[model samples]
Target: MIKGMGLSLIDSLDTMLIMNLTNYYKHARDYLAETLSWDRDIIVSVFETNIRCVGGLLAAYDMTQDEFFLKSAVDLGDRLLNAFQTPTGLPRTTVNLKTGAATNPSWTQQSSLLAEIGTLQIEFSYLSYASKQPRFAQKAMAVYDHLLTLMPEDKLLPIFINPDDGKPKGTDLVSVGALGDSYFEYLFKYWLITKKASRWGKEYFETVESILNTLAFKIVDQDEEMWYIAERQNKNINHKFDHLACFFGGLLALDAQHAPTEQMRERHMEIGKGIGAFCRKMYTMNPTRLPCDFVNIVGNTISNPIAAGKGWLMRPEAVETWFILYRLTNDTKYQEWGWDYFEAIEKYTKKEYGYTGLRDVTDSQKLEPDDVQQSYFLAETLKYLFLLFSPKDTIPLDKFVFNTEAHPLSFFEAQ
Candidate 1:
């Protein structure tokens, strides 16, 4: 919550900081400093630390012009670099700060999730830019460069990669969801942050086109008019969509703004709107007005509302897309949908201590609350909701590109 709150303060400093939230920033800063000082050798997960801690500190520094945040970020960045000591430039998933020992999870078979290795570019590249250290950026880009050579015939990467050989590990499971979402997210964001100077932007545009062509499906039933992106496994399409995948609509909408031609822009918008509409249905069709973890789309219609998991773990991807669509279209209906979602969260998930996840969002009579409340509930979920309702000028779309965690980083400042 501290990391996210710090970023939130940066996001709306003019309003939030003025609203007696300055103390919150001070508290977060002091806590981070104290923790780092006391636990100088604390081990951390690379993915979690990059998004929440490093991303938070950099954003706080940007907002406050405080050297403290910058210094902390640099310290954390140097510690994280130990994970990249692998032969293939694909960092291990975990790093020990004290011992400088890094290793992948024991469960995986000499492989790592594609999203884990592929999603570090934005944070690491920005760290290099901010600290004037090219090695951080180079290490991150090396992972991308190696992965590019391993793209499949369809140009869609598998969800897992063999870090030892820098090759794709799975052929059956290819997706823009779960283990693959932010890989594509960073491609566009990295391109945008670099002011289109990087080839990653062109790569991002091409990859989106490939995904739309190969993975996307249109469902045109009487009750459902939605576009679902499916996963390809074992030479067959798995007609499944997850709430996590819903972020694609927002990504598509954002990428449309940078389309090269009028025709391309219109096409991107059309696809984005189709997917956005489908994502909204994932919420409205559920009994609790919150989406399940997965829904199966069979042949031209949604087969079941909750075909897979019924839990809603306070995820932000669906609402995050809603925020983007609303920002792009100025459609009040998106706002109305978001309000409905918020009400559902309050009704089904709220607890006295703090909001918890729902064990079954489809069960209204006995709404079971899971014990966990993810930090993203504050970081991405509430932040996106706040941005959705705030003045459009609060964080102008043209001025900022939000990180995967919904932390807005200024494009102008990044350069």
Candidate 2:
């Protein structure tokens, strides 16, 4: 384990404040002030550090007017700036906190995943504004500027790109899943976070059009038609759907609100609902009511399903979309689906200390635990669940935009 910072604790601070766990919030704040240190020599995932620690701290600082949170965020942001010291301004995958040394992960020998390199914009842009450090935003925007030159005419960027030369690695595969989900996500969010004053808004609209024309498809299952987005390899389409891609539904709905025309808004919402419904169906296909990490869909048939080995990772993307859809449309059906999903999670995965993942979501009689509860479980999953039930005024969508990690940074500075 790379023990660089108090990731879980820092990530959950805003949640504690939102949930009004006053005692817990105070204790977490004190722990950060009294115990947490950023001087340790540990290698950390640059993406994770930015989204959870930087995003969470900034959200808390905005909410509570706490200088400690801002100070902590700035300190961490200063250290993470080391990762962007590359020829192309695309950051390495990992960096040493104390030594200012950086490198890509082993899986990618000389390239960085699209999502990792592109997802830092929202966090860094906010950081620059909050700290008056324009360098953070400049570095973040430099990556986007370089990517614009390399983005294909179809707008389907390859999943991997060389960090040093700013070129797409020779890969035919394109996905909005593990390696590339949030790159597309941040395009729209960055625009909204700037209150639609940034040029990225135009890019967001164009990319969505490209996605609809190229990557989206519908299939009939059990006499019910549903939409699912697919990835592409050269000219061939892969019907394998990723649980992570479930976030597309909420994204489409959110993006729809900012659509230039009412007709475009209606069309986007219609497709968003279709995608959300199909994702909910994935959970119901199994006995335990949890989705697999990935599934292959062939024509109208799902085949060679593999949930036994990898299992569920307590993903929140589907639920996150449902919450956003409910808020946007005032639809009770989305809330109902979220409640049903939560009940299944409570019955099957709840543990004494915390919830665990499932090794076999298909087996209700013997549900095996995967023993890995990701940080997003607390940061995104539970936060979305809570907001799913709370009134719209809790964290108004117009006033805030969430990072991929679900940390809500306000559109206006803290008053």
Candidate 3:
């Protein structure tokens, strides 16, 4: 199980880096318009699919110093946040395509949607960072507080929660798929930005690390075989790719303890490499195949190649890992691979929509209807890719590292 600790541990450090990639996102930059076809238009989202079409717009605005992109990103964030204007604090997973308002009464889901809010928080984080607006940070923090209330004792959050009532509406155990990245995204970024262990930050990361430890040994015996969490009652190996979930817990564990035992480091490596290698192998074996749309052990590879776990070669999340790995090794191989994925995605998918993150990239790179274009795909994927390819000096590496708990790792603040 602890196969390549040195390498994987190195790679984990690079996850969700945000130095220069913020600039490379120029092409996919955000822009809102009222064209001939549509009556009203707006920005995209992270809560549900197809909601965030112009996610890269804000990043682009920030990167290029262009007012167009800045307004684009902010406008989109504002549009989505407005939709969550329920009497209750929670937000609907998706909004009206035309009106950009939540026609739904309220959201009952927390795990994935909370993750979504975290992604949105990042956009706001950037808005706050660039403009020094407390409002963006406040909005992002408010969503985090809402999610904090919903997390369970097991440290594994429930799938969905009633935003109106604040009760668990779904299964007891959380899906590693939906909540993992966003959970840590908020945890690490919030800590890095605020540097405060006050309130719930420390407790949040503690729970995240615990849940990830669950994956290191059992569910994923090896790196490649990620099993979906079938039930909260039992979380044993249901061997298959639960791709996003596979990444979730492991990522938190990556930087858990400074100078983590050699063994612990090794486990993280295997997990990272396994995921990368499996994705590579699975895709290589069937070049024409899109990544699995989404797989359940009962019926593996049921969805399109763009599915999770066992799917196509190019994924925002998968490629995002390579960027994380690149930061660790400084190995050109990972950087090279990162470009390869960008090329592959361009080659395989088309741009039906402006925003990119979706489960299935099988068709034209159309953002999925159910898929909310997450701000995270940009924070994690495009940002990492840009960092992978760009000079290290752009973002001042030292500024963005250091967890809220203050894990004294050199990687985030590499010399």
Best by lDDT: 2
Model 1 clash pairs are: 172-233, 172-234
Query: 1-415 in candidate 3: lDDT tens per residue?
Result: 0121111111222232244333333222311222212224432233532123333444334334666545544554555565556545566555643576664333433323445545554445556565555565566567677777766665666556555564556545455555434555556555554444344456555664565466433233334463233323345444334455434332433443322267645655555555554444333343433345344443333233333433332345555555555555577876766676666556654457733333444444443433244334434555556767876664533444422111112221100
lDDT of 1: 0.76
Q: Give the higher-TM-score candidate: 1 or 2.
A: 2
Clashes of 1: 2
State each model's CA lDDT, in order: 0.76, 0.86, 0.46
Model 3 residue runs over 4 Å out of place are 1-55, 72-74, 96-100, 105-112, 129-133, 179-181, 195-201, 217-237, 245-270, 285-290, 294-314, 332-390, 394-415
Q: Kindly provide the TM-score of model 3 when superposed on the true structure, using C-alpha atoms.
A: 0.62
Give the per-residue lDDT digits (tens) of candidate 1, residues 1-415: 3322343333333223323367775765666555544134656778877887677666666667778777877877888888898878788888886677887776666677878888888878887887887788898899989988987667788877777777766454878888788898999998887777878877888888888888888877576456878988887888889888989989888889997778778877777777878877777776888878878886765644534487887899878888999999999888988899889888888889878898777767877778887767777887787778988887688877777777666774333
The residue pairs found clashing in candidate 2 are: none
Worst 10 residues of 3 by lDDT: 406-415
Ranking by lDDT: 2, 1, 3
Q: How far does residue 392 in candidate 1 sit from its true spot (Å)?
A: 1.5
* Number of backbone clashes in candidate 2: 0
Candidate 2, lDDT over the whole model: 0.86
